[model samples]
Target: MFEISDTQKIGVGLAGFGIFFLFLGMLLLFDKSLLALGNILFISGLACVIGLERTFRFFFQRHKVKASISFFGGIIIVLTGWPLVGMLFEMYGFVLLFSGFFPVAINFLRRVPVLGTFLNLPGISGVLDKLSGDSDRTRV
Candidate 1:
């Protein structure tokens, strides 16, 4: 029943992680002591950010208040947390890695069992179907 073009990709939030990894890689390239450790954090953070962005976009596109708040929240959080979060990735590797997976994990959950389909319903399908059906109804 699922169609290819009709299927949506889970949008990734790579920006946050990209920023985190970019900073971390810069930190690591500058300070080689953490080459191994930094690599892990970089990969994980990248996943988190890309995944986060996609998820946010998906839900954000749907609701009004939620979208507005999330849009503002992302800007505020990124602006405020940019330095702090970047540093966190640098100073605390594990925290950054965990941060990345947690969201992907949540999104992954929506792909499984009953709960997944229920929450991820495209929401617009039903409306479009109704409107397109028998446009002849409008014939005067």
Candidate 2:
């Protein structure tokens, strides 16, 4: 069985709430306040979950400097107004930061009952394959 510490549990809750607020903010036409709150919560939660040192290491890694700058810059922009533009920058940063994990995420999603069925559809499957960089692998 896997064990989770108290701080990590709290971190998960904070991260979930952050995601919820982000969705709500977008739904409400990108409210700056909610988006900013979500950003803070998400970053703090990440630090809590991974430990502050690890979080710092992850963001400050040599290759990730640009992405970290973009992501943090977007947060600053959002705080200064211009939610939509800030979100665009954040999206770019997020994609760059997480691109390496896409393949693992895609493979995990492919195992979920409902999502797996939907993703297995010809068109969607092809797209997922390309996104995950699995296009070169033979598909059964």
Candidate 3:
């Protein structure tokens, strides 16, 4: 059992991680429902992931066709796997949603040519690479 003793969250990824832990810690501290808070945050994160991915692809891509196709494909993957986790292990659906959704979306963002390359400025590249693990040479 890993304990979150220190609350000093200092890093570029602080916003992303700190919020989750803050809520989790509070839940533990107050003896409140933790899985519920975790569930809500994860679900909200999943929705944000979908919205961000679609919006970025829509504005950046030449046409809507590709984005629609990709979005539907992502939907299929997330939806199909969700039920299986429930049946197999009483899993949290949002866990499947966020963990599966974010990686592909971030990878897609890093692959976008001009926009992605623009985002690769200095510290940002390291952040993106670390978040998505995309090693495509074009990004560098």
Q: Candidates' TM-scores? A: 0.20, 0.95, 0.27
The lDDT of model 1 is 0.42
Task: Give one digit per residue, the lDDT tens place, for model 2 in 38-61.
Answer: 999998899889999999999999
C-alpha lDDT score of every prediction, in listed order: 0.42, 0.91, 0.46
Clashing residue pairs, backbone N/CA/C < 3 A, model 3: none
Candidate 1 off by > 4 Å? 1-59, 64-68, 80-140
Question: Which candidate number would show the highest TM-score if scored against the true structure?
Answer: 2
Q: What is the alpha-carbon lDDT for the whole of candidate 3?
A: 0.46
**Worst 10 contiguous positions by lDDT, candidate 1:** 4-13
Minimum summed lDDT over a 10-residue window in model 2 is located at 131-140
Better of 1 and 3 by TM-score: 3
Query: Which lDDT tens digits does candidate 1 get at residues 13-98?
Result: 33344445546644654333233334444334444545556645643554344434543343333335353344444344333324
